[model samples]
Target: MEWLETRELRYFTAVAEELHFGRAAERLGMAQPPLSRAVQRLERRLGVALLDRGRHGVALTPAGAVLLDEARATLDAAAAAARRTRRAVEPGGRLVLAVKANGAHDLLRALLDAYAREPDAAEVEVVLCGIGEDERMLRDGRADAALLHPLYSSLAGFDSEEVLTEEQVVVLPAGHPLAARTSLTLAEVADVPGLPAARWPLRDGGYPPGPGPEVRDLSQLAQLIALGRTSTVIPASARAWLWTAHSAVPLVDAPSVTTHIAWPPQSRSRPLAALVRTAVGLGRQA
Candidate 1:
């Protein structure tokens, strides 16, 4: 009894209840031989006949039935103890959050608020990751989790949730001819005097800079747009956060941006899990 592990109890209970070694192993996610060995070990330690073997089925003896009941209670108690320890560590634990520019919205803001207010989880670690490198960082465990586009959903070994959905807005140059118009369409900007529909340093595609201008980042793109460079199209939230001093109009006929929280399935960090819990809260809030 002292030397028998809880796993042995679990294995015995599974076989006792199922009355079948193969089915018990399948449920326990282990090979049949290993499960049979565990049951044999348990019976040996207790010095009792636990199961009556049969060609077509297995049945627990009376002693096995009593042991099965006790085993389940012991495992439940063990599980509760584990949860308490996890909660203790959750307080002020570290979390590595990976995010792209697209997911910076009210939902993310709310998630921050939740984490900041959680009782067992208030401390956090945030990382700014780009969409281009999102999958690698998550799959390789370089980052705990990330905010990504819908495309990242295709990446295996990870889970995701749509936390935010913001519509696209038309970012126009200040004092531009089309800026006076209430709204514009994609077809209207297709041949408009700027760069192609999509360009670097200009994610929103609302207002971009010169084609050869070497717009290294959004900061430069915004500066150029302020100086009446090419226009860009950006999500509405980005418009509020980054469209300062720039003329912005909603797209008359463009689709909205769907923001999702993506994370590797294998990570077991408590704080990282808290962030995901916060993401679920955000999803509910959405």
Candidate 2:
């Protein structure tokens, strides 16, 4: 088979995701017939049936499901290549760093300040992202680097250096009995009466099965904790920002959270290297 065009992959991906050619066509800003033909051509070239059309609806065959995943990755890589190429040729290059909002706490401030002191440090632009968003930003070239936690962020495709490792702590209402404890185990906090653990949105923007209130950010979670409606576990450093109405107890058995400065494995930017060095040095000091 000859090389497959990105256009064909994109068309097929949209159709596979939506399972409705008309909707996918509308999304692609093209007519349904052409989009349908494109997908058909792609299927013919691959010599396989991608979609099963019936009176009821459209569905993906086994091969179609596999292609959807690969096609999405390929599209993202192509886009990233284009974006990075443009950024490289700009008059004054800058490095964009993605960090989860309310994450990295005091360490972020220190990293930025220390890097700025470097003689020729490229201007570092910080992009504050939502939960589990730093990885996506890095993958799509929206960010040059990211400060991510190993527990919640995937580092499969990136080279990372550990910046800080700290124990986890459970945040609860100041008035709650558990708040008075010096340290609590995970089991002790799991089923707190009237204070179920807060549920955070997943990458798909859906909350995991839970009875607790759904929270999108730390600010909302903090408010819920203060109101005695919900509780959550977070890195120990986060305690520095808790409201007066909130109290934190270290989780004895909870896993330690490690913050890493991560960048694409193929990154060869000098500025990014210098920034990583600064972060590593600061981590050693701490």
Candidate 3:
């Protein structure tokens, strides 16, 4: 069998995702005819019908569905390799660590400080990201490592060590009646009158079905809580950044969130290993 080109995989993936050759072509910034031909050639090369073109529209065949997944993974890996290669040759390459904004809490600072004390520690560049973004940054080589929460991030493709685990608290407006409580159960927090649980964006950028306002980041959610617009359950450590108008009460039944230091297994460099070791050491001390 002939080796597949990244270009072919890219074209096929676009078509598979859009399910319309014309749309895919537009997305690729090319004409429809060539894009259609490229997909056809790929189908022939693979000896499989990747798409079914019925009168309604294009749909993926069983083989196409499988190929789509494989193609996406292959393309991501290729892109990651290119990025890593470029960064490696640059003078004094630094390690980039991605963390969700306000997600890491205290562990991030402690880890950075501890790692800096190591011999010849590379300069660390920290990238603050939104929910569900750290994993993408790590997978695409935009980051050498990421601090991720298993509840909000996927750890399927990386090697990770749990650095911190803490229970959750319900953050509410300081003036709210519930805010006066010393502690509350999840059920009590969930049905607070006029204060719905804030809806967070899913990986696909859609909010879960809820009556509360959708929030993109911790800052937004914090502001909303202060204004009595919404409430949310978050890791206990997040209370450090709560607004003065906000109150955080321990949620007795809320699940604990575990923060993990994750990195692509194949791209683990010396600096990344040292950073991970430092994080693990901190976890043991906690």
Please provide, for model 2 over 1-286, each residue's C-alpha lDDT reduced to its tens digit, 9 standing for 90 to 100: 3788999999999999999999999999999999999999999899999999999999999999999999999999999878877887766579899998867679999999999998758888999887898999999988889999978889988899999999999999999999999999999999988999999888776999989999987788889999999999999887777999999999999999999999988878888899999999999999
* Model 1 lDDT at residue 174: 66
Ranking by lDDT: 2, 3, 1
Per-prediction TM-score to the true structure, in the order listed: 0.58, 0.92, 0.92
RMSD of each: 14.4, 2.0, 2.0
lDDT of each: 0.68, 0.91, 0.89
TM-score of candidate 2 against the unseen true structure: 0.92
Per-residue alpha-carbon lDDT of candidate 1 for residues 14-131, written as tens digits (9 for 90 to 100): 8887888889999999999988887887788789999999776788788988888888867765664464346445546555566655446566677888877766564656665543
Global CA lDDT computed for model 2: 0.91
lDDT of 3 by residue, 142-236 (tens): 88899999898899989999999999888889999999999999888877789988888898778899788988877788888888999988888
Number of residue pairs clashing in candidate 1, backbone atoms closer than 3 angstroms, sequence gap of 3 or more or interchain = 12
- Which scores greater on TM-score, model 1 or model 3? 3
